[model samples]
Target: MSKSNPVVIAVGGNSLISEKEKVTVEDQYEAIRGTVRHVADVIEAGRQVCVTHGNGPQVGFILRRSEIARKVAGMHPVPLASCVADTQGAIGWQIQQALSNELRRRGLGATHRGMAVSVVTQVLVDVDDPGFVDPDKFVGEVYQEADLPVLREEYPHWVLKPDRGRGWRRVVPSPKPLEIVELPVIRSLLEQGFNVVAVGGGGVPVVRGDDGELRGVAAVIDKDLATGLLATTLGADLLVVSTSVPKVSLNYGTPDQTDLADVTAQEMRTYLAQGHFPPGSMGPKIAAAIDFLAKGGKEVIITCPDNLKNALESGGGTRITP
Candidate 1:
């Protein structure tokens, strides 16, 4: 694990939400402050960083707000893709500001020629993706089982599913990101020694028209998957996916559960095929790790945000290699 090579860090949406009672904007900002401190450590360690983050919780909050205004004040509801774009700016701004401030505090900012920027990124997705037909990405507030009927009556198009042991929540289509339209800009930022935060909520999902024009679509792209693609596209040496866990596990949450410290892409793919990782949990991360490694990425590290420094030190976290 060389600290000098470029690294793509995919921060999880849950990292922004500390607790159920602390979902306020201020709380999120504070949480981002904590995360970016670790990021600054990575930067100080000599790694050029490009960041991507999940927007599930933030997008859900915006959608809930829009839904409330639509029902109470007769306002138009925001489109799903628009909500994603909104969070990219909102969350990206928070991260950009926090990272910059942290870098400045460590004497790495303007005085030392360090900087950070956030891009309102767009990702290309296949318009005909089957995910649109089956909305699998869970979002928004969870509801009690008793509210299912009322929810169906209010939002007929919403697909409600039980989010593990949590509660029933709205699920949306999470189309695969095919290409990042702003990859050149991101690379340019890295070349300039500026840390970049891009591809929030897997980037505002978009599709190319017959005339090659791009338009936003009503779909969410998985951030890990998009980060993997971004890493490969940028030729990043490492893709560090910061999730809610410190490691990737086999048979997660069962009696025979085992945490993986290191594995090859082929071995992880075999576990993925064996149903060890579920789609809603570690599946996409594993898939992303395999994709990145297969696409010439030197390594992929799946760990929690707090463990990012240790993961880079190879002290912990699941490391996947080609």
Candidate 2:
């Protein structure tokens, strides 16, 4: 809660959408409102904040809608990067509105004015990253085996993988984020005491062209990695990752699962090396934590949204120390 140090919080995609409900615009707005309220609480405590969020469900919903809409009217569908920009705008607007109202209600407007701005960020990635050679990050809607042929014909480049019990979904190349294009702008916003929400959907992935121009690439970057990059670039004091679970666990979902309240970066590395974290899910989060700490980050907290306050105060979540 000091002026010198800021907090960068990354909210998971599942926080905005539940398993039962359809991911509608209204639902996303409501979810953003709840998230902003929590963020506003931190702001009221006199901490500067920046946020980055995942767009898995929202982008999937938009892509599916665009596909269906294109079927009725010959409207050209937007690209994946454009869809990420759209979610950034929509979700950012909701967070701004909610946080503004909450700040006004809490009478913090007099001393601490809260402003939320969404930046259409671009993240640089290697054009020849091996992730492209072997696309594995799942995106968009899940479909039954019967629907695969149709979807394949529709999106021939899409990689379809079968889930354990669930159906298949389109997977895209999720490359590591090397640089954040709007990092300077985010730093400016943070200096102005604004709660900036940038790097939505790991930022519209981009790569340099042969002509020395920055061009948008058809890929998604991992949100956690992007958030870590943002935190490191901004020199934030804490990187709080909001996920579904209150704390990260070793051997997650298995009978021998062990929840971790705190761990060092070295311990996380050991677990990662032993393949305790699977790349498909928890691997990126753990890797992001390690990367943050490796880059001189003071601390990182992994917890659920509802438990954020408790996690920060009581060290309830999986905290990675220096």
Candidate 3:
């Protein structure tokens, strides 16, 4: 892809913070900073970039802090939709500032295709979506056995699930995003020669009320799905989903597992139907890829943050084509 063909780079929020690393705010900034370097590499290689990011971990952090404040200081609890909004602004700012700084450090002047802007995106979801009735998107911190009784007693509305025996965590509905409310604004920003970062944590998951007003809802939208929509809507030829894996695999975690360097969207759909990708992880990404291709997207690159640069240059990751 050339500079004329902008690429939508979707970075996962959980991809920013690793369990092995410190989870402090400063640490989170450093994590994004590291990933920003690779994004700068793409920009330096003469490509316009529109960035989108996930906010699962960061949103959970806000939720945990709100719970603590509400219990200790009698502070009002932040709404779940508000928590998503908070992380969207916070994490979007981190990426925008980090990308700007990285570009500058590379001697790319402020106006040299480095004026990065973040849009506090609002993605619309259907109010009648079944997802709201059976919320399953995970958010917040995991509670140990000792803290379970208190958490359960206090937040009875929460849907807690066991996290592989690690602890119990809250799960919210992950509704499918119907439309991006700020689509026109983002398109305008791109047309004005700015690298836009929008749709953080799947665009603040909102729904339209019967009274014709847009209201925030307590749900998390899939970031990849939103990014795919953005890529299609913006008419970007390339969509890059920088996840935690270097490449997609078939029969993942098994002996017959095989890494895919290049595959067609049709092939990926076949694997998806066979249950090669689970819902909680790579499934959404593959689904996003297929959707993008179906909507006339030229290519999709799926790899970890570190491999993004090489993935574009030498097909270093799974390259899904139409």
Candidate 4:
């Protein structure tokens, strides 16, 4: 068999919280345990692995907690950027701990002892991105039609939008990620044979100031998009996006849905243009895959946690090549 390429895997939020009933911290930790086993498999297979993960649900949990505490115990509401940073640390810690334990259990003791670390990553975005002009990223809790008036009265600064079939939710700008601020440190960690978890929750969104310093922005960057940027920046050979589904599909959720495999970048781009992927779902991921492949990436894999091993070893997932 040929050597596996250096891979960057972007784990989706579903990997942590599959259902609303299992939204507890311990429950999410259990979910990470399963996903990290798959990550450990890749490491044992001799593939250099770097990881990034989403934190939408996790951030909402933190915000909700803060809101509840403020109502009952007189605490200040956390800022949106601060919420992103909080989840990055919390989720990164869980992933590193779980990956380390799995490595040790597999008898890779040396790799387990302080070999995994989480970086509080920051990603720079254009301050004037169109997203800020028309914020549409749904966040936090949903409210019923009856509560709309009360919600509007309570939080007039929030932008409310109906979430399809779901109720109304506060929306925020989801700006595109331009740069990873801690790229050098991440590179150093990877060079030292450590499993590095960086850019959690698409990184705390930031912008460059007039003095050439970074300032946090109240927006959430798409984790997959950020991972694609990281992959291209690091010159990674492959980008693996572990989402909720095992494969990318055409006409998803329909009777005539079709799974795609071994597709070229041009072919995927055609499908993307045809609106096969929606922005709220697979659209950004496909865009990210195309971005990575166009930037000289060898391939991109779209798969779920359960099929990660097969996807890496036997070309099981939807593969997009340049």
Candidate 5:
């Protein structure tokens, strides 16, 4: 048994870049620092936390940079697996460092002030996941119509598609995560009262070979789903999903939209089946919540970073119960 039961919080990657136009390193640091303050609030209340983050926007930045480097400087192209690893390190560093500073700022003890550790985690996936048959996860590098011919010639194996009137981008498969390679390490860290940042970009998506060797794959995995598995494995009762919205809504963006405060797992599944949540946005969150609850999780809180405390104390966010 663990000495401390940590709450698993899954933060979205886009949250690190608050605005589309303001994507500088300075901007990202400030955003992460702000999020850390909220996390510190929970910690100050004497709770342990395991932080996991998404890497959609961050991965796009790396992929775009890789393309630019290859075209302008004749550098070798970066593979998809490498891009995931790069973002994991970069984002994990931001969260861990910021959390450390925040803990110190609160005049906490030595253990609290320096307890954050970022793990470049690896998650195993099935070799025959059906997502490989139809690649659908979109990465960055949106190209103009004039660049299509060159892109097609350069990346013949890539699956390119239009990005909802924005431009064209490469779509990779999002395979299901099976297991975390460093689960024991993370569990040990939590048991020792250390706050852990792990499973960045759904844990680098690896697969095993016939010879019992692990190999990185060229794919993405859903961060929320991966977070759910981590919470279940870590024996966490609470799974907090931090997104842009403060609460989950039905008929979102429409006049009939209704906010959910406290919802049951079965109701969420019914709403999910009725297509209330779209796959690109809220769908994975509900699916993750249901999976967690089914696997013995007590509650899930879906809210924005700003309302994290209120969601925990005063019901400021949507709650999912079993």
Candidate 6:
């Protein structure tokens, strides 16, 4: 790869699945095709990229399906970590296929050109992380209040929480990602000119046991935090986080909302402290940008997938710098 060609992109869940749809496999492929076109444009411009993506909706769908399957035929329900792994495979396959097709359409060769690979990454975290004591990250399907007791009895570890104005949902421990276990493998793939996607759903949060082996834990890791760690580990020049919104904004959804084009890490932290970003939504993205910039990343861009190129060149979107 060229010296000038290093970027890590975290594509938001919106880019893969729309809120209006049920996220069927066909729909995911179509969505990924659009996303890959954007990525292919960047690659055609001579940038090496590593992509990460949010799996919230996709994993939730998988869990819901598994639950329904269990109810219908007495099949064993898959674990949350397993669902994350499933999404990694399903989404990665879509991305890889779409990227390959886009490259081929651009006249890039079918073999050994514009390659995309996905690694099932395990992110190390403390088994006793405070997040485990207080589950805050919402996951899986929304349920009625009457349905909570049955689920709670079935899954004792899960924390059932009611969303404001919405139905109840399960909240799982979302611990901070400590390290990307597959970083070396990812680096090797990138070195070989492959567009690697890893750390899906914060990398199947795991911990090293006393036996010195890695074990999957019943916890989620924030995708933005994992993406930040991935970017820093790969020494990426720029970290781009794609989201549903065109840019980060203060007083989001309010009449007084203001979009941000550029901001310093310190400013972002201040906004975070001021509650400009909600913890359930934009807060982690801001924190991730701050973390990346603090670790010496040249820039972090937060924008929707369509605005990525514009964000890079025109100083659009929310830019976080050290």
Q: What are the lDDT scores of the predictions, listed in order?
A: 0.86, 0.83, 0.88, 0.88, 0.91, 0.83
Could you tell me which residue pairs clash in candidate 1?
Answer: none
lDDT of 2 by residue, 1-322 (tens): 2343579999887787754464677777777777778787778777777888888878887888887787799677778888888888877777667777788888876543566667888899999999999887776677899998777787787788986678997777988899998888877766776778899878989999899899886788998999999999888879999888888898889999999987999999998999998886789999999999999999999988878877777778889997
Best by TM-score: 5
Off by over 4 Å in 6: 1-5, 110-113, 143-153, 165-168
Worst 10 residues of 3 by lDDT: 1-10
Best by lDDT: 5
Cα TM-score per model: 0.89, 0.89, 0.91, 0.92, 0.95, 0.93
- Per-residue lDDT of model 3, residues 1-322, tens digit only: 1224479999998878866568887888899999999998988998888999988778777888987898799898899889888888888888888889988888885673876899999999988889878877777777787887887787788788888888887888888888999988888777776788899988988888879899998888999999999999889999999988899999888899999998999999999999999998999999999999999999999999999988999879999999
RMSD of 2: 2.8
Q: How high is the lDDT of residue 63 in model 5?
A: 81
Which pairs of residues clash in candidate 5, taking residues 3 or more apart in a chain or in different chains? none
Q: Compose the digit string of candidate 6's lDDT tens values, residues 136-200.
A: 87877778989988887888877888877699988889888999998878888777778777887
Off by over 4 Å in 2: 1-4, 110-112, 141-169
Clashes of each: 0, 0, 1, 0, 0, 0
| Shift in Å, residue 83, candidate 5 | 1.1
lDDT of 5 at 222: 96
Error of 1 at 50 (Å): 0.4
On residues 89-207, what C-alpha lDDT tens digit does candidate 5 reach at each position? 98899999999888887887487435698999999999899988998888878788899998789879988888899988888989998899999999888888889999998989999
Q: 319 in model 1: Cα distance from truth in Å? A: 0.9
